[model samples]
Target: MANIVAGIGWHVIGAGMAASFYAPIEKVKKWSWETTWAIAGLFSWILLPIGVSLCLLPSFTGFYASIDPHLLLTIALFGAMWGVGNVSYGLTMRHLGMSLGIGIAIGVTLVVGTLVPPIMDGKASMLFTTRGGLYTMAGVFVALIGVAIVSWAGHKKELQLKGHLEEFNVGLGLLLAVMCGIFSSGMSFALHAALPIQEAAKSVGVNPLYAMLPSYVFIMGGGAVINLAYCFIRLAAVPRLSLREDLRQPGPTLRTNAALAATGGIMWYLQFFFYAWGEANIPASMSYVNWMLHMSIYVLCGGIVGLALGEWAGIRSGLLRLLWVGIIIIIIAANLVGVGMAYSQ
Candidate 1:
């Protein structure tokens, strides 16, 4: 019962964190994407994870030090790939709007993130051979269908708003979204590759949850490198991307940037933080479900926010109803994944 409570708490934390991540970006006024992303990156990809890992895990340094260089390199590369996806996501959201962007991104994330690790581990059959596995796969299919419905609703909304297709680029948005899914899913493989560091933490009598922190430090370093470079290039080209200039801007920009940076950082870290803690609650056999469940809740919360903000303002009431239906399907799909995990255990 305690474990179940822990799992539930972690899931809630994960969902809230994921949902709130983009809230900060909305606060940056007049700052270029380069400046805003860089500021947020300072906390999200760099400081927060390192600070938390250091504070919570005494053995973090030693555990990280003990990892094989080759394995470390591989994980770092995977993190870089995930960074590309992260960078692309902003562009996707800009081009596609949050409802459709998230729908497409999370949909691809669900399929690739759920399937790739199992396939890599040579346990692809686990997704089909067992009843639980089959159910989970079915959930994936259902979730994809939900995504399609949501995307279709977005298309309808766009047509209603603009009266034509030229205003929105569905093809480009989807392509970027698919890429985000593939690369974002790579983080799971990166985590698996860093198992040695995790074992080292266990060997030192630390909580396994604490052990995962150091690996995150290394993995996030890769993401940081990519984003940092992108920021620098933008700053260079624009010449006014200076933090000094950004701070000099009138009313709430600096304060908002700092607040957003802190919030986004904490929000970003919370995903892995809860993921690590949640993994401790569930059986190893059911661990993969954690990612699926996390992503599903994120989609649900994002969808709610999208509606609340009237992103679908001009769409017909019928399409709005279809949007809600899609959200329901996503929730059902998430529950199915949970059921599959329960049965697998």
Candidate 2:
């Protein structure tokens, strides 16, 4: 019971990290999106994963020596696809605004990432048979409802702030957002596909907390590779946003921007840093639900971050109240998941 509670706590903390990572990037000045993103990606996806892997999984050469190349390739390929999702996620918000875009994106991620892996693994029936798994599924559905409420509230808030949504194109934005969700679920798939690596880590006596580190190398680093490719392409296409010149500039501007971007990078990496710890506590039978729990908390905390940044400024009390209601429901939903996991354990 206690372990499950701690796992939920870790997930909340991880989601909070995910929610607020972009703050530092927002403070970055005069840098193109590609520049800041690439730098942040180094920390979130590549540098940090490698650094932590060295720390936790010490015998890097030995670890990979035993694993099949096919598994690594499979996981990395999924991670690469997930990289595309990371990019499209921003575009979704650009097209649909925070509320509706987030609602749809997170909802899709919750459903797809939660169900697909188990179905693929032929363990879908366990979800139905296990009382705890059923409760967790219930919590996921409830979280989806909360997500809808929050998204609706955000849509209402936007209306109150602006006369109308500037990016109200239903056809294009909706399709793009759905595509983003599908790709976002790839990270879940990557981890699912890397189950053998987990056993290898255990065979090598790796601690539970650190077992996921090596997998992150293949997964997160693989995603970073694609992101780097995209950013480099954008940089070449737009000479004005040349990251080379930005890095060449001397003094505080470059240093300050780099520092801010790096901070954001660290913050971004912490999402999964904490996720590893959180999953260590989840019951194996109920583990498939972790993605749902994660996406659910992410949306909720994102709403809280908006509130903190005064994004809801001058909002009508009714919509504001609706946002609060949704926030409450999400919190309850997270607790319900923890409770269900407890029973399953």
Candidate 3:
């Protein structure tokens, strides 16, 4: 019970970090989005991960030597796929806003990430026969319903703001959201596929808490390739959007924006840091439920933050009511998953 509580706490903190990751980006001034995102990715998907992983694993170089080349490539490939998903998710947000993009993409990610592994491993029967499996499954479906409600609220909000709808493309946004959802599940798959690496770490006397650190190196490495490539491509296509000017003549704005972007990236990386911690502590029997819990809490926290930031301000009362209802459902689903985790333990 104590371990379950601790795992839940870690996931909640990770979710909060994820929900608030964009706060610092709002402070970036006089920097192109491409430039700032590139800097942020340097930290989130590259430098910070490498630095932290080294701190966690003193012989990180040796650890890589121990992993099978084929397995490492497989994990990296999964990360690369997830990187595409991450970019698509950002595009979805551009067209759909926080509510709809997050709700739809994360909903699909949670459901698919949770179920596919067991099915692929030929343990589909466990989903029905295993203790707490039923509750976890219920929680997943309920979470999806919650996401649907939230998506509906977003659509209604769009209707309320129809005068400003010229720039929004619901169809494109939904398609990107679905694609993001499918590919985002790759991260979960990467972790599962890298189980052998984790086991190797454990055998080498590495603390179980930090065993996953090395795997993240490959995961983030592949992500860095995609993110950096996209940012560079954008910068090249629009030279004026590049950070060359900012770099050549460093100013207060450049310094501040770089710092803000780095901060955002570090915070973004912390989400997965905490996620690994939480996942490690969860009982193996119900560990799959962690994805659902994380996603639900992430969306729920985002909804709360969005409300606090007045993103829903000046909205029609009906739309606001719908948003609150969706949040409540998510909260309920999270609790159900938690209870299920406890029962599985």
Which candidate leads the pack in lDDT?
3
Instruction: Please write out the lDDT profile of model 3 over residues 35-135, one tens digit for every residue.
Output: 77778888998887788767776587887887899999999999998988887776776576665566666666666665676688897786788666777
Compare the candidates by TM-score and give the number of the best one: 1
Per candidate, the number of residue pairs that clash is 0, 0, 0
> lDDT for every model?
0.76, 0.76, 0.77
TM-score of each: 0.87, 0.81, 0.86
lDDT of 1 by residue, 108-198 (tens): 7777776776788798899989998998899889988887887788777776777444436666788888888888865777788888877
Query: Which of 1 and 3 is ahead in lDDT?
Result: 3
Where does candidate 2 clash, by residue pair? Answer: none
- Candidate 3's displacement at residue 201, Å, is 2.2
* Candidate 1 TM-score over all chains jointly: 0.87
Give me the runs in candidate 3 sitting further than 4 Å from their true place.
122-144, 162-169, 238-240, 245-250, 330-345
**Model 2 regions lying over 4 Å from their true place:** 92-104, 118-148, 160-176, 248-250, 285-293, 327-345
> How far does residue 202 in candidate 3 sit from its true spot (Å)?
2.6
Model 1 CA deviation exceeding 4 Å by range? 59-63, 122-130, 163-169, 238-248, 338-345
Worst lDDT 10-window in candidate 2: 163-172
